[model samples]
Target: MPSVNAPGLKRRKNRDGTERLYWAAPKSALAAGFPNRIVRLHFSAHDPAQHPLIEAACKRLEAEALEWTAGRRETRSAFDGTIASLVRQYQTDMASPYREVKWNTQRTYDQVLGVIEKAFGKRSLAALGISDFRRWYDEAKKPKAPGGSERVRKAHGIISMMRRMFAYGVTAELQECGRLLTILEKARFKQPGRRRQKLESHHVEAFIAKALDAGRQSLALGTALQFETTMRQRDVIGEWEPIPVAESAGGIVLGARRWVRGLTWADISDAFVVMKVTTKTGSEVAHDLTLCPLVMDLLARVPADRRIGPLIVDETAGRPYAEHAYAREWRLVARAAGIPDSVWNMDARAGGISEADDAGADLDAIRSAAGHSQASTTVRYVRGTIGKSRKVAELRKAHRNKS
Candidate 1:
């Protein structure tokens, strides 16, 4: 049993045989101390009745607690409670984004969040204004995904992410009172610069040779596959799904392409040296690509015992390469090959098209094999200046013979 000694103080005896003191602010001062108008004083049985120092210390503690409670601050300052912190919570919130987007899409947004955090992680949301956003927009280099197609820019792509985070802060009351929504409206994104770089002919031999020297067989094989087939990143290593088949006029059978699906080793015929694959263009269109000896040789590197599995593997994981992880592997291999930072899978397709042009393949032949919907699109891939020069010289010879 504990004896009550102090005024305006409540006492409770814990199971541990310790006495606790809590000061409950009266109804008149209900707005002070804590949200519940209660402040924890001390656990020891210190009497303020006789000790003036103890009584003064207790009064000071209560006053400080009340001040803190009035501000409604959980952290030291507004800097700790930031837009970056709010976005992180919104991303992982079980109620919203986690339930809305797929895992891969969520991963993509995480990259966007990372850039946002790096730039403004310490910025107080309450103090962020149009000038701060405009400065960020001018200075922020758009986050380009390692292998993804989306261009992440504060004004263009990442604005959606910014909008969502601010909106979440508002609904959750996590943000300090500010006009964050108004700043977002002022951003304008124009088209970014086009990428004109292409993987050249000599880079092919150098990359494969360097990859082999490093014992990176998976990268070497992945390179040849992308170069030969011109498949998109996911198509190279992604899982395959059975496409639906239907009968057409004259009892012809048509296998409709499923873009979401991918090609596997099971889709390849070693003897025929051809691959049938669902392409990125549409749901029903497919491509039948002729494989060269290089592609066949690369395919042979895979263990013969493997019957059916994802064709492209990380080797480290013994699984299909997640697009992001594979991009890292590609960069390492490219560095070993002495390829510049600008060269990527997009350039690999150009290498294949350039090879065809060097072999004197005409526009129609190149267009059909590359699956370009328009000649203009196919022409954009022609990077061999020597091949074009040779074609011009040959036409001059033919004109002289006609004269």
Candidate 2:
């Protein structure tokens, strides 16, 4: 009776006594070339069974009208059958592995893919060869600015992504991709050495002090949690993802932000242990919080009433921090503590592993604590074999003394 009471929604009654819903695009939308003057909706406004359908249509049309007026086009880039086209294909094709990866990983892949598209998008796959790639590799690894150091890691990432893309092409049974893969197989690229920087105890202490002084308790807790439990920053702070149109269901508007799973208070046990599965490896890890005095102290400071939902909430947003915001805020606190830019928040996991090894903890035990599926993965985070070497030296001296 109230014409569905939504913007751009109206009711039309037929002489046959049937009522149907119609959407009227606003003048602004009309000026922007709206598709039609009045779009008839499939649902009837008078039917209680169809009211939900009418409501959904109304909202969708309203959003469409807004977007049309805002000049936002959802057009796809044309495919020219070049490397850029292939990249787009890999990204959009449902069967492509790129479509199946986690969002964070997709973001990483996009960074490298963007570089590939920009550099060689116009070049035909048949024209690219080992020589072209080798020359590009040399140029990419060079310093971007005068007096700046070379970007070996960044260059290495590009090469690695290219290899994967070519391999993907072979999987898709593209003859050109198969040839490219064969060529790539014969090439060797510069491999950057593993990172040696580990989070030091002083760095942790300073970060905590600085974060607390700035009144960012969540960040202080996050730092201690990451350093002590060997958990990733994403596992602690959570991530923001777009709410799908079909699943938007209310509260958070469609196309806005929604929180993915992260560390929740329910993950903690009565013994002050954090037990949860790692997001990356899907391996369950249990960390005894009582053993980590810093982490425990920070947890204790949180009021009982606030100790609910996500363990780490960005006070500014009253919700979990997005990945970028988390890093930016962490960097600010880190800079205040005089921590160098070379050392990242991610290095905290490595710092914890190094500390555990240095304390003479068993290798297998450390591996389990880090939630690594293989011992080798955990070993990479140990930074150095200083602890193992010290133990070997002590054993040698003892044998000599006995003799």
Candidate 3:
């Protein structure tokens, strides 16, 4: 038998002496979302007759890999009218809702889009029906473990992304997508329950104590800042975004990661007032740290030399923690403080909003404090705690007695 001339081909031998073949894609093929970095060539390894087929398959896959690497996959002849194509169109189309979202939000949408493409990329959009989607939903909603909680949120997110994609297809005048959207409108799915957990003062104190003890002063201060200011975690922790093609003049670049501005010392006035433009709403919000003793005390403890850059710097990286890293570190500290996993770093803002409601602050004031453009948006985060209800009851009784 002669050696085959197929590149990237590997053969593994079994105990029974039969061999299995695989084509390993180059590392760069990851940009194309290549599965497990390899494609199985279903040919008998001992058969010389299979060599030509194996070589052909390898060449074709390699060409596709190169096409993806050059970023020309969308423009290539392979742009069939599949859900995958729709995903590509929805993502790149400037008028699509995907483009309207903030950078952090787009990142999440990309993850769900990847899931869509991987699962249904080859499936024809015209053939899809409510039954197919229901089956997909069932598969997506399954628990990761045998008895673990169902992934209701994950399932809902996938369906939401699919709906958005189909809606975009309708905007683009795709007949199949419009039909799918119409069919989906009548379909029923289980909705995830709204999260009511809020980080309370005790959780904040415990987190701060744990963070400080762990030598994570920045994490401690960041927590206090978010809780006191009622700012989103993204606004407090900041985020790394890709440098756009247009211009690269602004934003701090560390290695390949471009840092969007988070809460910086420059944003804080000498009088301990924070004036910041939030990432989500782009709303400028001002808060007096002097009124928040925890924030002020934490600020005072920071030496002048270290207070020059971003307000919350990861001690380990000497810069802002990536969103995942921040969440992970926060979870560790929160767990150390005996805070339940249900309460998240994001809940700090909710906790602050709820605290404001409990403190007898007007709805308008709470909304303003939250930097929300609408009272309805602020209302979502404000949990009706026992303290707020008790205050309302006391006020009602006092008014009755006076009457």
Number of the candidate with higher lDDT, 1 or 2? 2
lDDT of 1 by residue, 105-193 (tens): 67678888887888687786656766776566655544455654444344444566777777665555342422476567555645355
**In model 2, what lDDT does residue 192 have?**
87
- Candidate 2: TM-score? 0.77
Candidate 2: misplaced stretches above 4 Å? Answer: 1-81, 249-255
Q: Considering only N, C-alpha and C atoms within 3 Å, which residue pairs clash in candidate 1?
A: none
Give all candidates' CA lDDT scores: 0.61, 0.82, 0.82
- Top lDDT model: 3
C-alpha root-mean-square deviation, candidate 1: 18.0
Per-residue C-alpha lDDT of model 3 across residues 289-313, encoded as one tens digit per residue = 9999889889989889877878888
Candidate 1 residue-pair clash tally: 0
User: Pick by TM-score: which candidate is best?
Assistant: 2
Which regions of candidate 3 deviate over 4 angstroms?
1-79, 245-251, 395-403
Q: Provide the TM-score for each candidate, comma-separated.
A: 0.49, 0.77, 0.76
Position 323, candidate 3: lDDT: 53
